[model samples]
Target: MDQPFRHIIALAALALPAFATNARAEEAALIDGGKLLLTNGVTTIEGASGGGLASWATIAGRGTDRGIGLSTHVTLIELPDYGWQSHGVALGLANRLELSYARQNFDTRDVGTALGLGKGYRLNQDVFGAKLRIAGDVVYGEPLLPQISVGVEYKRNRDAPVALTVGANAAKGADFTLSATKLFLSHSVLVNATARLTKANQAGLLGFGSNGNDNHSLQFEGSIAYQLSRRAVIGAEYRSKPDNLAIAKEDDWLDLFAAYALTRNLTLTAAYVDLGSIATFDKQRGGLLSAQLAF
Candidate 1:
């Protein structure tokens, strides 16, 4: 071959390897199939779904990529005589970890006076959280092992003292959680279990505490999810909390959820949540909807 032709051939050969490397890197950055929304627990996303111990082996943190993503959720609850609502947004950075912020609004309806807070009393709280994947494979040839994650959250109450007494002094507090997850490739199912320690003063707003009381408690959360198709999944979760208040007895909640992926960058989730109750209020039930976007 002529010298010019030989030189061109050499340059083309070198470019091929670089292109292949870039392709592999891009594949690695994509989220794995077993975990939806880059979360280890059930569809709840937060600690409510527990971690890796139940049925879904999904990990909680983002993947190992250096990208950012966003998630938002809205929740509604129906009490015996009142209704409550909450909205939240979270940001994920890289695939190694995530940071999130959430706000909850509660409408007392007619139960406000019965709870000593009065009618139309609304309470709001803010939550800040971080999640880190400590171990496990993001892309694995074998399907039995799932990822592991560790995380924490700090909650601040924005409710006025006279309006809501449960979180009067709950200005700043923390929750620590650990999770383990595993995926069954043959069955297309994921299981996750998690344990947490918290002094959050409320379920951070799910309402499990009162003012003048601060006690550390342990909670267990678990979830199981099965992929119904390439873009859809169904799951459930259960959480156990503590009753650290002199005014109320904390109860547990169960959740059933469904999620659908619209595209590589977007997904939507919906759930039916039975919160049971927080004290003498024996009937509390709710629904939640969420959307997630990744880039």
Candidate 2:
């Protein structure tokens, strides 16, 4: 098995028993949860607490009233001519603050050979993020106010030479996001809107900006989810990308995803993603699979 997959399996094996023991010992004592099961959210691309493609205004744990929660996820995407794999860990404190770290590997695949870099070329990136939920409540259905949060992602690309060759101005950049998320329990629906300021191209895989325009631009990302059952959620997400480099124009990303909670601490998510064009490769649509372990 691949090293990353092995690591995930090992970690899950070790943690699952602890979680099961704790739950068994405390089953009768219910922790007054502020949000619904699987509602705290799946991990975002940048490792924040949110949907698959974009970050939401929620923290990363089921412990809503108080306590700490930790979540880790492994995501894999197989595009038409490329591939992407990401894994990350996030920790949420008191359902008010969140911190995360993620590693991304973009596989050039055959495209690498076409670009004269041989086959199987990969670009690596690391992302560190922090978020603070400032106001409102997602489950506060009585007043129907949206949850609001602010976040920042500091991204660094390891393929600096390749990024520069592709017209990227820098290998490092930061993105700031302000998100508003609202959930209607009566209607079993949730909606989120986010505005982001970023200079990173292709979510930092292609690096930050270009020579001509080295400043950040405002972008939008959103998600809408419907709760089908106590443990199932179906959602769709859209994320607009920055067009910074001239070598290969970036495009918007979209995904239709479903998440099912096997238990309070385990959730699985799958999605059909249409990433539009990436690096001049059209129709970079693919499937995504993600497993999240949370406590």
Could you tell me how far off, in angstroms, the CA of residue 79 lies in candidate 1 after the best superposition? 4.2
For candidate 1, the TM-score is 0.73
Off by over 4 Å in 1: 1-66, 138-142, 160-171, 206-213
- The most accurate candidate by lDDT is 2
Candidate 2 clashing pairs, residues 3+ apart or interchain: none
| RMSD versus native structure for model 1 | 12.4
lDDT of each: 0.55, 0.84
For model 1, residues 15-84, the per-residue Cα lDDT tens digits are 3454355446665544433234434232233322232112222323333343334445555555565565
The numbered model that scores best in TM-score is: 2
